[model samples]
Target: MYCPFCSHIEDKVIDSRLSKEGDVIRRRRECFNCKQRFTTYERVGEIFPMVIKKDGRRERFNREKIFNGMKRACEKRPVSIDVLETVVGDIEKKIQEIGESEIPSHIIGKELMNQLQKLDHVAYVRFASVYKEFKDISEFMSEIKSLAPQSVVSYEQNPSKTIDGVPL
Candidate 1:
């Protein structure tokens, strides 16, 4: 595997494991040239269906697009990178498992919101604000209040509290 940092072609697998319920292999690679470490995931390449946008336009599915959005919502929060990864993986897997040639963008957005809701309330609100396009502070505060108890529960229980740390 090529090292992502140095672009070195030669590398050794320092670790390997299954990810996203064993659908993919997550590998930790160490570059022989620069000794830099990176990760790679191997999965059965499937032809994902085109995502039909709300505007009635069709586009190819891109997991990175969702990941970037999730990252933004999760920014400056206790959310962990691994949690974002897992959420993205779950969304992708759900789409692929449906055995369809096309999927709606709304469904993808809902799935993202669902995953984010369970992961972090703050992140969920951040994402929802943008995804739902709140018009005023009331709308934003409603979302925040809706998330309060759950956020408190999560905060107290998991003080180390990283988004990528636990699926909950």
Candidate 2:
């Protein structure tokens, strides 16, 4: 291993641990030259399917993109980072289990939306807005309505009330 502090190639592993899922290994390393410590993660480089975009372009599957999108959707919400990480991990596992050389982007998007919907309604709508590309307020309302029929009915009855800080 290379030392991050001094770019030295020699390092000693101080500790090593497996992730909860047992799919990743974390190692703590100390540089021999600078005596600096850093952590590194190791995981099997499994082959993933290429994502087929809306425009018919194929690109390598990116885990970071999914995590970032979910992060943005859950921003300022009560959701925790651990929950988001688990969600991303679940999606990645599902994709791998599909065992396809190429998969439609919509499948991934729908799965993410489904996961977020169970996590937080506000986050689900936030993600759906972008993923589904709502053209107007009605389209957005339709999604919210589908999430909670009682809440939508109450909002219709009382327009002054707000759902997730948004006025009806």
Candidate 3:
């Protein structure tokens, strides 16, 4: 690494440490020529996969875009920022686990809808209204209705009940 003090190309690493989660390396280095010390962080290059849109356009995957869409859907809702961040992280992890360099936009939308549906009904309806392109009230109502439980045998039998139909 080049030294900031004397612009020397030679440097010795005085200390090295792994950051939280071990995704990056933190290194403290000393310039050989100026005796100045500096810290640097090294991380693996993130090769984001490409997203294929429904309109046949290809673009790089962006976390900001996903977060913005989620934020809009979550507006006027009780969802917390931490929850949103975790959802994003989980989505990214799933996409990476697939090991494919390209994925359809609709697939990502489906994943988002699944997450929003579990997070908040209002947010789920809001997100689905846009993602599913509801042409009328009937479609919207049907989407929401599917989320409601028709009958629960007994609250005691169903020890775990959740708003999104998931067993808590």
Instruction: Give the lowest summed-lDDT range of ten residues in model 3.
Output: 159-168
**Tens digit per residue, CA lDDT, model 3, 83-133:** 787787677667766566777787778778768876887898888898888
Q: Which candidate do you rate higher for TM-score, 1 or 2? A: 2
Every model: Cα RMSD to truth = 10.1, 12.9, 12.6
lDDT by residue (1-168, candidate 1, tens digit) is 667888889876655555556456676777999998888877634446778998999887766689899999999999887667667767876777766777778778877887888798778888999999899999888878877787657655765642322222
The CA root-mean-square deviation of candidate 1, after full C-alpha superposition on the true structure, stands at 10.1
Q: What's the lDDT for candidate 2?
A: 0.78
How well is each residue in 47-159 modelled by candidate 2, as lDDT tens digits? 46788999999886776689899999999999998788778877876787777788888888877976887799999999999998899999999888887867646645785
User: How does residue 136 of candidate 3 score in lDDT?
Assistant: 93
Kindly give the number of clashing pairs for every candidate. Answer: 4, 0, 0
Best by lDDT: 2
lDDT: worst 10-residue window of model 1: 159-168
Top-down lDDT ranking: 2, 1, 3
lDDT of each: 0.75, 0.78, 0.73
Superior candidate under lDDT, 1 versus 3: 1
